[model samples]
Target: MASTAHRVCMAMLALPAIALAHGEIVVDVGHTLAAPGATSARGRSEFEFNLDLAREVTAALQARGRSARLINEDGLIPSLKARPQAAEGAAFLLSIHHDSVNAFELQPWQWQGQALDYNDDFAGHSLFVSRDNPDTARSILCARIIGARLQRMGFEPTYKNGRRRAYADPMHAVHYYDGLAVLRHATMPAVLFEAGVIKNRDEELLLRDPARIARMADGIATALVACLTAGQPADDEATADGPPLQPVVE
Candidate 1:
């Protein structure tokens, strides 16, 4: 009887990990919060770019054997309230946005002698899990990767001083803290990044380009992959209040 029981225990112990080893990084591109009356063509365009970027990232990841998917549809935000369970067990949730701030003029361009104006909010940031033992390290890793790539690609950083700061090599603030709705409810670590200012003449131009969107997506996918490579679970829930997800960075 002891031997039989031992055999049963061995069989149970041998079961493979059920956690999606080839984890799914869920992309949510319908970032709607601040920028009221942003449902116009321009607003929609900004949102569409995010979708394209995610698709590009997904394709690149597939090429590299990392499984990824977009939970949101083109030009539509998912009804999270309608289906909260899908977020459960996801490796990560990345909500993408194009900052849609009002246009403003820069004096002396602050850093340079050029007159600068940007409609882009440059509100690039991220938020992780708040739950104790919130497994968010992987998502943070993903944010860092995306930030680094965007910085290198000449995406100007809009500092709190309302100035465009030079991208500090190897230390892009692309990753910041927030406790938005998506972050709070998500069972996995999640983030929301303002890809660029879509309202700024230059940024708006870039956002409209397929190549640029593709590059952004590729960067995100690569970063998420890196986080998965690291073997750490989510950290304990943090006590701080993360920024809201609706207003998005920008």
Candidate 2:
């Protein structure tokens, strides 16, 4: 009996891992409660927005009968590298985040008697992928798919921040940002989605709307499913070259 059981276990281990490769889509919630990311115009933490939208996205995916997992749902995952490690076998990793501008761009404002910083110059969504990722091509493909879907749903793409950002797809606002730990450390295809510029007061209000949030979540869910089921684009089809390390004196 022991020999037979050992044989069965060895046979199971020998099975192809193709099914495991097509595992659950990991929706990683950016930042943690203790070290919440960028602060919004209305004093809301970026983590709050990320968690909210991630929840909706996960639910939407499950509704479509797709395997989905939400990482850092409790806002407790502290290490950036650990986030990707948790998604070791995931088909893809989408890190949800709210955007903010540089400190110099922020203008002082009063919200309910409290001083706050905000930037209204840029308003829109942005997508990022890391060239260091093993599946960089697939990462860009998925980013483009999500960006195009968001654009089709009436969400414009932001283009003002060009300092250290490189446009992988200018039309879709997909940037090749190799510095993002979550994207660079991920073994599977990965994308860092900036849902909107929360620092832009006007856009912040729009993104804060529950109905609009639901729509955005739906768009993400649809795009992810399409990317996963669609044919994989040729590796050469996606090019990722990040910006130069030093600024040009000229």
Tens digits of per-residue lDDT, candidate 1, 95-186, equal: 66655554343211221443434443344432233221133344454555666666676654545322332121225553333334565556
lDDT: worst 10-residue window of model 1: 234-243
* Model 2 ranges with Cα > 4 A deviation: 1-22, 238-250
lDDT of 2: 0.80
Q: What is the C-alpha RMSD of each candidate to the true structure, in Å?
A: 10.3, 9.1
> Which candidate has the highest lDDT of all?
2
Off by over 4 Å in 1: 1-21, 32-44, 74-84, 102-133, 153-156, 160-170, 174-177, 231-250
Q: Cα miss at 187, model 2 (Å)?
A: 1.0
Q: lDDT value for candidate 1? A: 0.50
lDDT of each: 0.50, 0.80
**Pairs of residues at least 3 apart in sequence or in different chains that clash in candidate 2:** none
User: What TM-score would each prediction reach against the true structure?
Assistant: 0.63, 0.86
